[model samples]
Target: MNFEDFIISPRSFKTESWQIGSRISKGIKEGSIVLLFVSDYRGVGGDAEMQDFTGVRKEFYKLSQLDFEVPVIDLGDLVSGKTVEDSHYILQEVLSACHYKNAVPVIIGGSNDFAFSLFSALNFHQKNINYTQISNIISLKQGESINEQTFLSKILGSKNFSIKNYHHLGYQKHLNETDSIKLIKEVQFDIVRLAEMMNSTEKTEPFFRKADLVTVNCDAVESFNDPFSMNPQVNGLNKREICAYMKEIGLSDNLQSVGIFNYNIYSDNQLNHQLLAQMLWYLIEGINIQRSHPKERHYEMFYVLIDDTEYAFRRDVFSNLWFFGKDENIENCIPCSRKDFDEAKKGWLNPRLMKI
Candidate 1:
């Protein structure tokens, strides 16, 4: 399928040298970032209007680049298909193309089911995919088809796809079903509650630290003026907190794909668009900053004996980032928080290390 038939080019660009638009185009630079906008919302399992991303691009293009050297390309809006599955197929093709070229794809999405397309394309890239999601609800119940409610179930249960680790962040106890939460624990998947991430993004940072694909449900965001998501919750992360998390998502050394889903395009709220645009900007900024880290090996290793077991910690002397080693070797080290390092001395098994 010719990609031009499915993607309309983004038109927004600013005259300022520091504007993000200055770096966006159709060209695919190796190791660069590519943006895809999806306007179709049929997978939402309700009467949904096709989203208009013109305001989002306008706001994003106007933001200062902060002298970032990272390259970004906006491939424009995805054309809605005759069926929701048709849309998913076209999206999978596009994502696969980006993956083959070794470019990071940042998807501004139509619904949560878009993740199915992202997950499907990921199979072509590599095995043992580490998928991470930030959302306020867990809707993994089996449905008639792949929609927002059953996308996670489709991904986790798919025989063709191989997901090594599935991490759920920002989940609220009230919004999630008891059975689904219990099922997650029974499977031993890593899940962090909304209350756990309110003031401390650090606890959640480790989740994103090594993630391959990260998806954020916009409903997880709290908006007062107008509902920014289809299932907007009364309590969720604020703009600043959400943006900070987006930066963390971008900083991932293994991050390859991302999606921001459930934005209520039916509403004419500029604030909602502005916030989403800024969140994307922060993500790009973070990718640029993370890439600038020195490649030279400057690790400082510390070993401790706790409860008859020896634990090893390694710190990047340059970036001050900490990692918990499975053994003495740095090659097996897993990204961890400074707090995890502190707790290791107290004989507490840094649970984050087990996921590695």
Candidate 2:
């Protein structure tokens, strides 16, 4: 597929030698991070006409390169199709191309429902996907048409999509429907409240460690001077906290795709643009840092006996990351925290960790 046929080149921006934009190319390279902008917001009751991303690009382009080893490519805005379904098809094609090149696609500027397209495209190449989403609302309203409120239902209900695990983070209890939250719990999926996500990323880093697809709903972020998301909330993640989480998302060892959706495309606030740009920078920074780690890892094993049962834990000597399992085989291990290991020594175990 010719990416140029489906994408409009990003507007030219002047850049200094040390800036990130100076290193970003227009063409996709092997093992690159590809940025694709989608303007289709019809799912969220907005028009398909091109949304100006000049503010974001300007901020992103001016940021320091900061020793990044991975290539970055801006594929520009995706052409909106006649119908929303058509737009999904176009997006899938572009994503497939990125996958073929062993590149990670960071989708920007689309309605939250476009997450469905990201799932569909990745499902074609792999199964038993681990999806992690950061959204303030968890709506499972049944509908034939896909929109922000109903897209989660479409993803969870589709038989064609093989989701091994789904983690919904940053959901605010007051904003979510009781039934929807109940349903998610009933299905044994992980649903984390907004309060659990604030202040630190250590506890939630495990959720993203094995994620294959991670999507962020800008609505989960709090608005300051102007609205940051299409449906901004008064109580949500602050700029610093959200940027920290974005780095965790990028640090995922198994990450394949990402989407930043429900962003307030119409906002003229430079702060909002600057925040988004910084989020992207932090994500890329995490990716570069992870890539620098040793390919072959060694672990230190520790064991604790609880109720006549031996529980085992392993800590990577290189990364200092902990995992819980019966043995040393990494596949059999579940990503865990030092806190979990500490609790186990006291003859206690988190039931949720056992379930996973």
Candidate 3:
């Protein structure tokens, strides 16, 4: 696929020699982090336009590149098709191309519903996908059109997609329907409240550790000055907390794709743009750090007996991350936290971990 045909080239931005943008390549490279922007917000009742991400690019390009060696590419803004479905098709092709080159595509802009495209594209390459989403609202409305309210239904209810695990994080109890929340739990899928995600990323880090795809709805972020998201809330993940989670998303061992959607493209606030740009930087930094870790890892194993059964937990010697399993193979184990291990030693187990 000649990717140029499907998207506009990013506008050139001035950057110092030490800045990250100065090191960004315009073409995709193997094992690189690719940025793709979309402006089709029709799903949320906004018209498509040739949106200028100059503000974001300018801020991102100016940040320090540090010692990171991972290749980064700017594929530019994706061209909105005549129809929303057309946009999805084009995005799927572009995402597939990136996957073919072993690159991770971080999609920016567009309505949150475009996440369906990310899922479809990855589903074609692998099965049993582990998807994690950070959003303030949970809607399961049934509809033919793919909008923010009905897209989750389409993904979870669809017979064609093979989702091994799904985690919905940062959802507010007041914003979500009781039935929808109950339904998600009845299926044994993980759904975390906004309170559980505040201050620290330790408990939630495990959710991102093995995810194959992750998406963030900007509505889940708290707005300041001008609105930060299309559907901004007064209470949501603050700037620091959101950046911490972005890094966790990047540190995923099995990460394949990511989407940051429902952003306020019309915001003129420099701080909002800077926040978004820094979020991307933190994500890239986490990816670089994860890639730098040794392929062969060492773990300290501990066993806890509960109700006549023994459970195993392992702690990584290098990263100090924890995992739970019944054996020594890390691949067969589940990502966990120190809190989980402590609770286990007290003869208590997290039901969610048992379900997985």
C-alpha displacement of 262 in model 3, angstroms?
A: 0.4
Tens-digit per-residue lDDT, 84-171, candidate 3: 9888889999999888898999999999999999999999999999999999998999999888898999999999999999999999
Compared with the true structure, the alpha-carbon lDDT of candidate 1 equals 0.84
TM-score of each: 0.94, 0.97, 0.98
Count of backbone clashes, every candidate in sequence: 0, 0, 0
- Model 1 poorest 10 in a row by lDDT: 43-52
lDDT leader: 3
| Residue 55 lDDT, candidate 2, scale 0-100 | 95
Task: Name the weakest run of 10 consecutive residues (lDDT summed) in model 2.
Answer: 325-334
Show model 2 residue runs off by greater than 4 Å.
1-3
Estimate, for each residue in 1-356, the C-alpha lDDT of model 2 and write its tens digit. 55468789998889999999999998878899999989999989988898889999999999999899999999999999889888888999999888889899999988999999999999998999999999998999999888888899999999999999999999998887799999999999998999988898887888999999999999999999899999878899999999999999989998899999989989999999999999999999988988888889898989989999888889989888999886656966888888889999999997767873
Residue-level lDDT of model 1, residues 1-356, one tens digit each, is: 78768887777655587677776778556888999988777777544345578888888888987878877888888888878888888888888888988899988968888988888898777888889999988988897777888999999998999998899998999887999999988898988898888976887787787788999999899977999888877799999999999999989878889999888877788998899999999899889888987766578888878878887788889878888884555546777888888888877876658755
